[model samples]
Target: MRKNGSNGGRAKYQCAKCGYHGYLQPAAPAARYAQVEKLLAERNSQRSIVRATGVSRMTVANLAKKSAISQPTAAAPAAEISPAQALGST
Candidate 1:
């Protein structure tokens, strides 16, 4: 049992054990969610995104898939060589 105050007292929660006092604040759901969306847009790696986003990487992947955003594909490498070969024949 403890008294909590804004000044400098412990926040109190009842312990499941033999009756003890504990103090900690749970995270707000919305704040945690916004972090996730931001990270996905940044194209961060899954593990790094999890650390920064405060959400599971799997969630980020799902959002990315659902986002339906298309990225430009790299230029073809083989086509360049073929064009040079075409010019040499003439």
Candidate 2:
């Protein structure tokens, strides 16, 4: 399955199993945001989280903001009024 290029450069390769082509670039740094978020939730400092997770401080901050935005928060429940207050006796 080896064939030389028409330009006389290096030969081209085609995979029969996966059909993958060209160079595959590495993923972005935010890929480890889960770990970063875990560390952030541990009350670790930004610098400490960066040091432990090897993620840039800026990226960590951005991911933290994104996580916060995605989370759903529950509203506080209303307090029960006393019977005296209800009867206007207070």
Candidate 3:
């Protein structure tokens, strides 16, 4: 592949043999995201997480929202009543 030109302010490359042209997408920062997730799990505030991890506020919020949606919340236990309580006899 060879550099063709700039596309959308990113370097565009073209296949040397096939004539296919496109911009190479950058890889996701997995390590940074892992750090963000760790800080989030530590109960750090979104702003604090952003400061600590150098990730954007929106990114932190999105990760938090995604994790919340993915994890299942435990159901609250139902209250039990004795026969006397059920009869309102205290």
Candidate 4:
């Protein structure tokens, strides 16, 4: 894939407390995006987000994995058939 400007992949960062080395990420190395996505997906209100995540609405909206598909709820099906169909009367 072609990259525009400086994409700058990964970088090494030193842990201040233990002097351990780790890789810093362009998004988030430890899967913070997954959390952001979960929050966004739950349709939680923006004010509630700030109260909980300490991030603004714009940030929450931006960080979400905007392209993922939402699965239909389990208790209800997208399509349903009559009980007679379930029997052998179709």
TM-score of 3: 0.54
How far off is model 3, as Cα RMSD?
8.8
Where does model 3 exceed 4 Å of error? 1-28, 78-90
Per-residue alpha-carbon lDDT of candidate 1 for residues 18-67, written as tens digits (9 for 90 to 100)? 56655777588678766766776777676887787577777777766765
Worst 10 residues of 2 by lDDT: 1-10
lDDT values for all models: 0.66, 0.72, 0.89, 0.58
lDDT digits (tens) for residues 1-90 of candidate 4: 222233356555666667766664454524554665666678876567667766667776555434244544458545777899779795
The prediction achieving the highest lDDT against the true structure is: 3
Better of 1 and 2 by lDDT: 2
In candidate 3, how many clashes are counted? 0
The TM-score that candidate 1 achieves is 0.42
TM-score for all models, in order of appearance: 0.42, 0.50, 0.54, 0.37
The 10 consecutive residues of candidate 1 with the worst lDDT sum are: 1-10
> Candidate 2 residues 1-90, lDDT tens each?
333243345455555566644433346655677788888778788888888877778988887788778878887888999999999995
- Clash statistics: count for each candidate: 0, 0, 0, 0
Candidate 4: regions farther than 4 A off: 1-30, 63-84
TM-score: the better of candidates 2 and 4: 2
What is the Cα-based TM-score of model 2?
0.50
What are the C-alpha RMSDs, in order, of all predicted structures? 8.7, 9.0, 8.8, 10.0
Please estimate how well model 4 matches the true structure, expressed as its whole-model Cα lDDT.
0.58
